[model samples]
Target: MSDASPAPVTAAILVIGDEILSGRTKDKNIGYIAEYLTNSGIDLREVRVVPDVAEEIVAAVNALRTRYTYLFTTGGIGPTHDDITADCVAQAVGVGIDVDPRARAMLLERIKPEDLNEARLRMARIPFGAELIENPISKAPGFMIENVIVMAGVPSIMQAMMDSVAPRLKTGARVTAETIEAGNLPEGGYAEGLAVIAKAHPGVSIGSYPSMTPAGFRNQIVVRGREPEALAAARTEIEALLARLQAERT
Candidate 1:
C-alpha cells in the first residue's frame, strides 16, 4: 500500500466592508468560517480584511485566489452604495457581472415583486458563469466563480451559505488534536522541552494556551497533526515533560 498522503486543501478569507474596518460593525464571521473550514478538512491559511474600495477589494481577491486552493469573501453584497464586493470579484476574475435571473428569483421568494426595487435588485447581481450558493436565512443567494466563493457578511446567512457549499468543496485529510491539561503549570517551565519535542515531530503542531479562573491560572497544551502516529508520539513526549516538571515541584 502507498503511504503518501493527499495534497493539502487550503483556503483564505477576504472580509470586505468599511464597517468592519472602521470598527462600526464587529466581524463575527472570520472565526466561524475558520472553524468551519478546519472541520471540513480544508486548512484556512490566511485571512485579509479590506474596506469598500473597489481597487483594494479586487487586488486582495486576485492575490488570495491565486495563493490558495479556494478564496472566500464576505460582506459588500448588500443593497447599499458601499456594496461592491460582487463587482470587485467580477473584475478580479475578468468577467462581466449582471443581475442574474435565478438570483432575482431567490430574492423574490422573500421580497414582494412590487417591493423589488433597484436597491433590492442589487442583491441579485452575480458574476457571469458563477454557481449560486443558497442562503436559507435571507434568501439573498451567494455565488461561487471558479475558486472564489462569495457570501453575505451576516453571521447567520454566511453560516447557511457555508453549509450550502460544504459538500461541493475539495477536502483533504482531517486534522486531529489532543489536549493535555497542565493545571497551574507555567508555560516557562516546559517551553524548552515542548519546543524540542515540536522540532522533533515536525508534522505535529504544539501550542500552550493559558487561561485564568477564580481559583488560579490554568494551562493546556494542545498537539495537532494529520498523522495519528506522529500526533501520538508528540503527545506522549509532552505528557512526560509535564509529569517531570510536576515531580520536581514536589
Candidate 2:
C-alpha cells in the first residue's frame, strides 16, 4: 500500500496599504482570512503587510505567489489614486492590465453610467486572462491571476470576496486541534515536558499559551495535527504532564 500522504495545501496573505503599515487602519482581514483558510483545509503559512508602494506590492506578490499554493492579498483595489494593487499584480505576473468588460458590467450594477468616471473605472481594471471574483456587497469586483487572489481592504468586502473565491481553491486535509487547560499552571513548570512530548510526536504541533486571569495565570496547551490518533496521543501526554506537575505542587 502506498503510505505517502498527499502534498499539503498552503497559502500566504499579503496585506497592502500604507494605513495598515502606519497603524492608522488596523487590519481585520488577516485574522478572518486565516480562520477561513484553516476551515477550508488550506494552511495559512505566512502573512506580510506592506505599504502602498508599487515596488513593494509587486515584490511581495511575486514572492508569495511563487512560494505557496495560493496568495491572497487584501487592500489597494479601490477607486482612489492609491489603489494600485491590480496594476502591481499585473506587473508581478508579467501580464497587461486594462478595464475588464465583465468587471465594468458589475460596476454598472451599482454605479450610474455617467458616474463611471476615471477613478471608478480603476476598480474595473484587471490583469489579462484572469478570472473575476464577485463582490456581492459592492459592484467593484476582485480578480484572480495565476495563484494570486486580490481582495478589498474593507473587512466586510474582503470577507465577501473570500466566500466567492473559496469554492475554486485547492484544499487538503483539515487540521484538528485538542486543547488542555492547565489552571494556574506556570508555563515554566511544564515547558521541558511539553517540549519532550512535542519532539516525540513529530506529526503533531504542540503550543503552550499563557493568559492572565482574575484568579491567576491560566495556561492552555494545544496539540494540533491532521491525524486524529496523533492529536489524541499528544493531548494525553500533555494532560499527564500537567497532572504530574499539579500533584507535585500539592
Candidate 3:
C-alpha cells in the first residue's frame, strides 16, 4: 500500500439502456452522479451512453473499468428481461454470476418470498464476490464488482445508491472552479488567447463556454483545479485576456 493519499481520483459514467439511446427516457442520473462525484472529490472524467446489448455493455464496462479509478453504470438492473447489467458486469469481469442470497433477503423485505417470481428474482442475481450498494428508496440493491458500480436507472433510486456507496469510495481532494463571465465577448475572438492561457496554466483545467443569453451571446471561461493558487492565477490571466478583448470590441 502507498503511504500517501492519491491527489486526484478520476471516474467515468456508463449509462446503459436502449430507451435512453432512443431518446424515450431523459437521463437524469448522469448529471446527478457527475455533480455528486465532483462534490465528493472524485473527478468525473468521461461519460458514455451505450445500448442494452450484452456485448456492448460488457465491452464498455471492461474498457471504462480499466481507464478510470471508478466506473459508475446506471440502468438495466431491474425485474424486466432487458435488465441485464448484473450479468454483463459478471461477463466483463470474467466471474461467475448467480442469485445472491443477501440480495434475495433484501428483496424479500419488500416482496414476499412466495410472491418472488422469476422477474423479481432477476434482481437478486449478482456477480461473484461483489459488494451491495444500498438503495433506501427501494430495497433492491445495486452491486459493485471491482471498480464498476452498477446502479438502478431510476433517478431517485440511483441517487440513493450513490449516497450509500459514496462513503466507501476512495476520494481525493475536491476540484475547485472559478468562472469568469466575459460579457458580450465572442468566443472566436478569445479562443486563441484562451488556448494560450490554458497552456500557460497546465495545472488547471481552462475552457470557454459560449451560451445564448437573453442579452444575446455571452461567453464564460471556467478554470478548475485542485489547488487554490493555480485557480487564482488562471482566473487572473483569463480576466486580463477578457479585458483586452473588450477593449478591442469598443
Candidate 4:
C-alpha cells in the first residue's frame, strides 16, 4: 500500500498589539484570517495574541514560522511607538530591517514629502529580501518573508493584503464537510452508535457538537473528509445511525 499523505495544509495567525492585551481593542483579524484560510484549503492550526514588546513578538514569530506551513501576523506595523513588528520579525529571522525602496516609492506617491517624516518613515521599514503585500485602503504596504505574511492592523488594510496574498498560497485538496442535526437528542445517548459508525468510516472525521438548553441538550454531528465520495458515504451512514437512535429514544 502507498503511504498516506498529510491530511491538510496548515497555517498559524499571530495578532500583535498592546491594545488587544489591554482590552482597549477587541481583535477582529483572527476570525477573518481563519475563515479566509479555511475556505482556501489551509487549515488554521493555531492563533496567538501577544503584546507589542519586541521580545514577545520575535519569539512568537520565530515559533509560528517554524511550526506552520504559513504564518500571518496582523497589527504592530503602524507609525506609533508600539509599532515594532517589522523590527521584531527582522530580529527573529536574523535579518537587518531597512527602508525598502519599493515601499518608499509607493509611499511617496501617496504621502507628501513633509508627511514622510520620522513617524511615517517607520512604515517603510521592511526585512531584507521581503516582498510587499499591497494595502489598497492605505498607502503603507505590508511585507512577506518566506512563508510569513505580515499585514496591517486595520481591518480594511488587512483584508486587502489578504486578497493580494491568498492567490499565491499553495493549497492542498479541499476538505468537504457535512453536518446533521439531531434535535433535542443528548450526545451521550448516541455516543456508542456514533462510535461504531466512526470506526466503520475511519478515513472520515466525525465530531459531535453539543449545546445545552433549558429543556435538554442537542447535538450537531459534522463529518469532514478530503474525498467527496467518502464524505457522502459517511454522511449517509451517520444519518441512518441518527434515525435508528431517534427511534430507540422515542
Candidate 4: which stretches are off by over 4 Å?
Answer: 1-3, 199-202, 211-217
Please provide, for model 3 over 44-98, each residue's C-alpha lDDT reduced to its tens digit, 9 standing for 90 to 100.
9999999989999999999999999999999999999899999999999999988
Clashes of 4: 0
Which of the predicted structures, 2 or 3, would earn the higher TM-score when compared with the native? 2
**lDDT per residue, candidate 1, 1-250, as tens digits?**
9887788999999999888888999999999999998888899999999989999999999999999999999999999988999999999999999999999999999999999999999999999999999999999999999999999999999999999998989998899988999989899998999999999998898999999999989999999899999999899988999999999999
lDDT of 2 at 187: 88
Model 1: per-residue Cα lDDT at residue 210 = 98
Using lDDT as the yardstick, the better of models 1 and 2 is 1
Off by over 4 Å in 1: none
| Each prediction's whole-model lDDT (CA) | 0.94, 0.93, 0.90, 0.89
Number of backbone-clashing residue pairs for each candidate, in the order shown: 0, 0, 0, 0
After TM-score superposition, the amount by which residue 194's alpha carbon in candidate 2 deviates from its true location, in angstroms, is: 0.7
RMSD of each: 1.2, 0.9, 2.3, 2.2
User: Lowest-scoring 10 consecutive residues by lDDT in candidate 1?
Assistant: 1-10
Clashing pairs for predicted structure model 1, backbone only: none
Q: Residue 220 of candidate 1: its Cα lDDT?
A: 97
Clashing pairs in 2: none
Residue pairs whose backbone atoms clash in candidate 4: none
Q: Output the TM-score of candidate 2.
A: 0.98
